[model samples]
Target: MTDRKLLLRVTLGWFLLLILAYLNHFQNGFHFDDSHTITYNTAIRNIKNVPAFFSDPTMFSANPQHHHLRPWVTTTLAVDYWLGGGLYPFFFHLSTFLVHIGLCLLLFSVYKEITGNALQHRWAPWIALFAAGVFGMHTAVAETINYVISRSDVWSTFFIVLSLFLFIRFPAKRKYGLYILAAVAGVFAKETVPVLLVLLFFYILFFEKNLSVAQLFTARHFKTVLGVVGRLLPLLLAVAIVQIYTLTRVNTETQDAGLSNPLISYWLTQTYVWFRYFITFFWPFHLSADTDLKVISDVSNWRIIVGVLFVMALLVSIVKTSARKETRPISFGLIWFAASLLPTSLLPFSEVMNDHRMYFAFTGLALAIVYAAGLLVIRRESSVVAHPSYKKAIIFAMALIIGLHAFGVHQRNKVWFTEETLWKDVTEKSPENGRGWMNYGLSLMSRGDYVSALKMFEKANTLLTDYSFLNINMAIANAGLKRNEEAVANFARAIMLAPNDYNSYAYYARYLVEQQKFAPAKEMAEKALSLNKNDIISLESAMAAYQGLQQWDKLKQTASYTLSIDPENTKAANYLAAAHQQKATVALPSSGLKTSEDYINLSLVLYNAGAYEDCIAACRNALALKPDNADAYNNICAAYNMLKQWDKAKEACKKALELNPNHANAPANLKWAENERL
Candidate 1:
């Protein structure tokens, strides 16, 4: 076959393999950070907000604590929202997968260039193909592809590789600033793109100038090194300008990006994290969405010592290989791997390590591993190289490796299939991670398994006492189980822990609205809205409060404002219509309640409205009509508890429980009343 036909067939094969490997992940639901950025974020609900995404950092997330200046990420999310007509996980995952394909294609071009430069063997193209295939189908990359928000890592890495490709493939375009422009675009996608400057500097040194790593330190090549630095000054200046602009424009104060570990310990932990990242590139079986790894505060710890030695070994290998032209690609790839990790290692992010972080570093590791293997094949004697069986063995080995990685990717897709699967996997793999357990509880709560959810929340509480989100989830689970006093206490604790976080206030408002406390619900909703005006949940809560209180004017205003922000909100539209239909004074029914169920329903309405006395009287009337009415006794018990009549509340609760052993609220009310009496 001609070279063009061969290349075409190989590229087609790669595409098919990638599709098969990731097919299961296309419909995978959003996980973790996707909640704040896509699910609840109202800004991306409207395409008109795309322009605001670039100018306002807060447009990145509904949660103020997560806001950052990734305008390109937000812009793509907005476009996906527009195309999908809502927050469809398929559209988001499709966009991310397409970007992954683009990144893999770029990786092919980059690997080909570096491989051709290192070894002028006829198999350079095939080696590049193998490297690209390994990276494209690798399980580590699957973590990033499956995560919608981690597309920032993929996009930024794509631009970095694109910049390198342009610089290598089209030297003439350097003067036109195409490569630098790619780097600039990457900066908007993610702040880690600045590492491209270091990458480019090393590329020019190894490939362009054909300089060895040792020559830079020798007196003979000092001028040559200076000239390389001089050539990089323009790119450096551009990167610096964009980085400074990002730093100044982003609201760092609002972001809760800091690690809980002390600075020294965090840095030390990263040393071990690098070791973990390195091993996972080769053996990805231990990947976790949330790791239970902790900081290494002790400098003398064995893991820290081993990690330091591992890093030293890698640096030594890079230096040793850089001294030879045949191994320059290996050295350069190692440098790429190390440089890619520098930003995350030096900075103290909330997470010490993440599986998706391998997306960038593994690109270079693939090149190194493939090129080193190719070198072994070429260095073999002519008899061995020409042996048909040997070639078959080599091909089979390559196919097996790629096939295993593809299979691993498919399996990880199953793990990421839904919130329950994902968090359940985390709870298993990272059992010590309180956040993981809490998130699993949230999934159970979402499915209305409050009893099981509370068990998970209680387990999480033992691990993460001060974690505000955990407290909020605990409050929600308690309320779901009808443990009213415990729920109230958890809500107060959550607010106390994270006073500035709007989620606590918004969730509390929702609970209050459910309990028919319209005034307090409205107040909490307004407070949450003040923190984040674009929060749709808070707006809905406020509308519910207004409707419950029969404040038609305020309900109309809140619903109108919500509709203005989200034009396709059917709930807001319904609320606005309800407000229009409501009259200032509606006449009550002229006839008195005759059926037991009717009196019981009236008691529930009165109980929710805080008219405890009236609620108890209605419940008594329901009992008079139907002596065996368990719901009436339950209502009376709830009303008495609300009124702080503990003895009466306990008596009524016991009677309700006696009539209906499965009475959900009776046992909780009885327990509360008994505790209060003590």
Candidate 2:
């Protein structure tokens, strides 16, 4: 085949593989944080207040609410809003799919450069294509691609691969600019890519050395070196600055950094994650969100032994191949795999093993596999080191591994259909996992079966004690059952357990407002607002408290600000209009010909507050809003009789009974009105 035709064929095939992957994940809706972080999340969907998402991560309406400082992720979601309105996951998935295809093509080009010979020319492109295709659809990537909010990881892969492709283009100097740009972009993708950057620098310094200050900056000449630091120094400085920022934003949340067992314990668990990736690399399985790693409480655990054996095997292969004069790309691949995984492999981070974290790291292993295969194919072309039987055996092994892995990926992708199914499957498979219990609680809660939801939370609390989240939510269930005292105690306990949990504080403050503890209710709102500057719930609560206190102007501003964060908030808009009229100190209309329903709602609020005239005026407004609303007329009649407008009230009650003879309240109030009619 002509090289051009071959390239076209290869590219088309690469695209088809990604198309299959797209269909798989597209059939899957979002899992994990997709609801709160992207779709149902009010903070991310409103495009006009885009800067607010960037400026403040916690967008609970109150400025003091907790939010992760991940503006880069939000910016992409904001753009998604502009292109496609809220709740559409299709465009988001399509975008990531296209990027995945582009990444494959780039890997093909990089492999072509690394194998600069006639024999490797054809084999390298195909090998790289296989690697990219497998990685793209590798079922393990569902967490990063199928879960719409995980575009950050997909975005990072594009840049990292793009930078690598450019670094391999003719005359590496010209590609230096692209390299820096890609690195900067990847830095925002996640804290994971810098490990790749440092490893690449080591590779260029030792392996790809062309010898100049710029070349020197990229070189890895440990034994006989030239130009190394000046070109690298500038990029290193930029990376350093970003690192400091990430550290400030991420590091200070020390408690959140969470528990890391002994270094030995971590190292032992890491083996299971690594081995799991390898197994999935060959055969994808039940693929879950949170996976428990096999532990090594003692050196006796099988994971430690297996992991050491694998590491030693790779080390021996690299050293033995170096003595044979073969290029060290396989060694580079192993190191690349190992190095790219360092960030995720370290002490406690999220969990012991997340399959998605294997996305980029799989490439290193892919490279090792493909390169080893290429060596077998090109055995006739002068091997820097040769053994025909060994090459044939490696080829069979590679084919067998790929077939098994493809089956695995296909099976794993099926598990991502929906959250309820996913977590239900997890609970069945790993009943002891605390997170599984918590997630199942949410699924049950969404269905509104509160009793079952409470039971799930109770089980979850057993696994992770002292969790305010479970307590606060449990309070919601108690409230549903009308167990107010129990609800209040639980809410208070939640607040005490997590003082920073503004949600519990705002909700409880709402309960306090209902109880007429206006002063204490207002105090709690102020405290929550102080902690989370733009918390929407707290802002509304503060507005409610001020409304109770008759501080109209302050209530107006708080309600208006709250509505600005959430433009579709009808309740806030109504509150704002009410506050505006109240601040004007104008007499609320009591005798309006229409406005009955509004009057009814207002009357209800006023009657509870013991304001007779205001309640009377509210009924008048409701009747005006709907002249034939007999319920409003009846309410007005009751208010008027309370105010001793006896004749008018009696006449109003007659009008109410005329609408329906079964108007019980109308007859009772009408008798009272007639008793004192003047």
Candidate 3:
């Protein structure tokens, strides 16, 4: 086959393999950071807000603590929201997957250039393809791909690779500043793009200057070293300018700098994290969304010692390989891997290590490993000059490795299929992660498994006593189980912990609305809106409060505003219609319980407040006003069940059924009473 045709066929094959490997992940739900950055982030709900994303760093996340200046990330998320017409995971995943494919293709061009420069062999393009395939299909990359919001990592890495490709493939374009523009664009997606400077310097040192890694330090090559730095001056200046601009635009106060660990201990823990990253590149197993690894306080700890030894060995290998032209790519690749990790390692993050952190570093490891394997094949070919079958054997082995990685990617996609599956996997793999346990409890609570959810929340509270989000979730779980006092206490604790967070107020408002406490609910909802006016959850809570308080004008105004933000909101439309009709009706005082429906509503409020005796009294009043009222009988049965009067509960449920056989709550209440009686 002609060389161009061969490249086309190989490229097509690589694309096909990528699709097959990641097909299962396209529909995978958003996980972890997606909640703050995409789902709850009201800024991305409208496409017109995209411009503000560049000017306002707080638009990046609903949670103030997570705010950062990743305008490109936010812009892309907003576009995805517009394309999908809502928070659809598929479009978000597709965008990330497409960027990943672009990165892999760019890596092929980059790897081919580096490989050809190092080996001057006919198999350079094919070897580059193999390397790119290994990276594109690697199980480690799936951790980033399956996570929708981690698209920031994917896009930044793509631009970095594009800059490198342009620098190598089109030297004439350097004067036009194409590569510099690409690097600058990458900075908007992520702050780590400046690491590209280190990568380029080493590329020039090994490939352009033809110098060994040790020669740069020798006196003989001092001028050559200066020349290399001179060549990089323009790019370095551009990066510095872009970084300064980024710093000015970002909100420094709320940025999550990952300072959870003390500096010395965080640095110590990173040594072990490096070892784990290195091994996973080769083995790619036992990955977790959240890891249970803790910082090492002692320098003499066995894991830290092992980690230090691994780093020493890696440096030695890089230095040894840099001495030979044919092995320079290996040295360069190793340096790329190490440098890619520098940003995350030097700065402590909440997580000491994360699986998605491998996406960028593994790009370099893939090149090193594939090039090393190519060397072995060349040696074997020379020893057995006519052994054509050995070529097939190498192909088969590579194909098998890719196949296993593809299988692992598919399995990991399954783990990310739903909130419940994802958090369940986290709890299993990262059992000591209090956040993981709390997230799993949230998924359970979402599914109405409050009893099991509370158990998980209790475990999380033991581990993370002062976590505000955990306390909020504990409050919700307690409310689901009708533990009113505990729920109220937990809500108070959550608000105390995070007074500035709108989530605490919004959730508390929702719970108050459920309890018919419209006055407090409206106050809390307005407070939440003062913090984040675009929040739909808070808006809905305000609408509920207005409707309950018979404030037709306020209800109509709030619902219309909600509809403007979320045009497809059926609840808001219904509330607005209800407000229009109810405007002419006279509002009733809360103390005036003159009707059966009013007494039934009061009974529900009492039951939600855990006032079971009061609930029963209200239900009795409802029955007296409207004899044979099935709802009143059902309310009496529910209150009796809560009071553990099983016999009385069963009798009320039976009466409710006789009054109206189709009553919804009577059957469930009777079943519960019977089960508890047994």
Candidate 3 off by > 4 Å: 1-10, 384-386, 550-567, 570-678
Per-residue alpha-carbon lDDT of model 2 for 1-678, expressed as tens digits? 786688678567546545654566565666776655664356765665566644454531222222455566666776675576445666667766676667767766765655442233546666666665566556676556666666767677667777777665744474357676776767665666576565566456435553222323333543434344554666667666765564455423312454446666777667766776777765566466766454567777677788777767766765544332234566666667777777767765546776667777877777766677667666654542366676677556655554455455555556666777777767876777777887877778777878897898889889868878778778877776678898888898899898876677877777677777778889988887776535566776787788888888787678657655554444554566567566423233343212345456656655544455655655654554466767776877887887889988898899988887898688998999998883
TM-score of 1: 0.84
- Ranking of candidates on lDDT, top first: 3, 1, 2
Give the per-residue lDDT digits (tens) of candidate 1, residues 55-142: 7888888887788888899999999987886778899999989988988898899889888888887888888988898999998888
TM-score of 3: 0.83
- Give the TM-score of each candidate: 0.84, 0.73, 0.83
lDDT of 3 by residue, 294-411 (tens): 8889999999999889889999999999999999999999999999999989887778999999999999999998999888787677754677677677778888988899899989
Alpha-carbon deviation at 462 in model 2, angstroms = 2.5
Q: Flag regions of model 1 displaced more than 4 Å.
A: 2-4, 381-383, 580-678
Q: Rate the local accuracy (lDDT) of all candidates.
A: 0.85, 0.65, 0.86
How accurate locally is residue 466 in candidate 3, as Cα lDDT from 0 to 100?
92
Best by TM-score: 1
Count of clashing pairs, candidate 2: 43
Each prediction's RMSD to truth: 16.2, 12.3, 15.5
